[model samples]
Target: MGDNDHSHPFFLHHSDHPNLVLVSKKLNGDNYTTWARGIHISLSVKNKLGFITGDIEEPSSSEDPDTHAAWRCCNDMILSWLLHSLKPELVESVLFSTTAQAVWDDLCERFSQSNIPRIFQLNRELATISQGTSFVSAYFTRLKGLWDELASYNEHCTCSYGAKNDRQ
Candidate 1:
């Protein structure tokens, strides 16, 4: 078993299974940003980020049979994990995708578009958030989450003046 092989990109533990829910919340089309971050963190921890990132390419069938087989096994596991994370309606769209990277790219293209209404909603929530009956920590957490989501939609300026102003 390659479970103990930390250097191998396709290493999988005995417990790693397709039915494992990587993120608590399923991808339902509206929460792509947070859903993507959660999926990314989970896959990174599993040493399978390369499968979705296209960093790990599949071996040609003409290559060593064992190597190609191993790649296919890992890829199918990743594809299953991804499909399991999505809503039932969404699963059909990418169910036939041949590679994990293809499935990931399809989902990203479908849901990660710049949504103006969503950005407006996040900004509104940030502006209206208050402690109310919530504890200070809880209030702060809600506020921070909204800010972070809104920040994800923003484009950071790379100019020297922008950098200087940000530091200030």
Candidate 2:
């Protein structure tokens, strides 16, 4: 967990379990939730789910005898991985957070703006969007991207909530 040592072997998640997508170098505008989900699944596979779930409290010092030393180290490693995943511009904002859960919470708060006015504006734009003179395939691609963005923000389109929402 020391700043100078990058030798922590436990931090790397290289297995082919399917849901574990390595954090990308740059997480741009709307990719936060997707990135977070991947990180969560990967961490879960490592039995370190508590690091981001707030179940494991961050240790104040590695020297403290009562601390879960290995967990603390793993938590720091996870936080480091999360830091590496952020876009360079966003790194500064979350850097001050002490624990992985705090960082996760801060990111969720900042990026998960489901009730924001921008969602309404995006909806309006999508409703009025037309192919115009564009090629059919290109138009479809653009439309699909807009729909994906909408689904990411809308919450109900996600599989977890979709079933419950559908029954209502």
Candidate 3:
């Protein structure tokens, strides 16, 4: 993959036939365990900005104050760092899974006019697609209007990161 091309693994329950692309030649060894349960794996689609980043961690119910604080800080730090690195000009409208729609909604509302270059969820599936580009496979098409609104959101983001590049 080139500097601009990145891919991430997205998982689904063993019986779930998710449509997300899987770039791997074969499933990971961990899937062997799930294979006993008949699970398959595939590569996830990538967008201009990058893939919709997701992580799998052991579920925890700990609600300690310090834990929550650290978690929140880590989340912000991750997004802040990505914004610095990828510096996406415009993010696609999100299409998060039902599991994450509320969070996606909050993001859309928070970044509504701000063009920090993030996608918003327009449907139940989290595919990072454009508003209407099949509503299925467009990750950066939402950027169509980026040039028109970037100046306004860049001001909200207040950073020089990826501010001087354009598609050729």
Candidate 4:
């Protein structure tokens, strides 16, 4: 397929496989924020984010047979990648999910907590964190990781504060 044609969601690189682990760290009941972020980046790079976001719907079997087969192939591939990225214990929970989105939503509901208590805990950790016996790089990495997770819990203002007021 041509470059433009191959950009479709159904298109998979020869190297792509169901057993591929999208992230170095598997989801182990904790570290969902970082793990999910890593998976999003990897899937986005593969042009498969839509599978988890429900943007790419499966074609009907009656629709063109080729199209239906292609969609099922891509869906199963994405599902396998998601399963491979989770810890063995966690995999059993999501193993039966038919779609990548179903597995994603299930995991998200189980681990994606952004409540006041969580935010306060992160802030407290940030305040007490120190280089201590750890190397400078390790300290910085830990601090940065906490900061990123906290930032993800925050909601950004969509209103344009810099825009000129019509009444002005």
Candidate whose TM-score is highest:
1
Could you give me the TM-score of model 3 versus the true structure? Answer: 0.21
Give a tens-digit lDDT track for model 2, residues 72-142. 65667777777777877888998888777877767766665533555677689899999999999999999
- lDDT (10s digit) by residue, model 3, range 1-168: 232222311222343232322332222222221221121121111121111123322124375555444334333333332222211332222222222222223343333333222322222133443466355334455544443233333232211233222210
Root-mean-square deviation of every model = 6.5, 8.5, 18.5, 8.0
Screening candidate 1 with a backbone cut-off below 3 angstroms (N, C-alpha, C), the clashing residue pairs are none
lDDT of each: 0.78, 0.63, 0.28, 0.77
Q: What's the best-to-worst order under lDDT?
A: 1, 4, 2, 3
Q: What is candidate 4's local distance difference test score?
A: 0.77
Residue-level error in angstroms, candidate 2, position 138:
17
Supply candidate 4's per-residue lDDT for 128: 95
Q: Model 3, which residues run further than 4 Å from truth? A: 1-62, 91-168
Q: Estimated TM-score per prediction?
A: 0.76, 0.54, 0.21, 0.74
Q: Candidate 4 regions off by >4 Å? A: 1-4, 114-117, 125-147, 154-168
By TM-score, highest first, what's the ranking? 1, 4, 2, 3
- Candidate 4 lDDT over residue span 34-140, tens digit each: 78778888989998888887788877888678888888898999999999999899999988889888888778666665244677898999999999999999999
lDDT, candidate 1, 11-107, per-residue tens? 7778888898999999999887778888888988888888887788888888678888888999999889899999999999999999988888777
Better of 2 and 3 by lDDT: 2
Q: Candidate 1, 155: how far from true, in Å?
A: 8.7
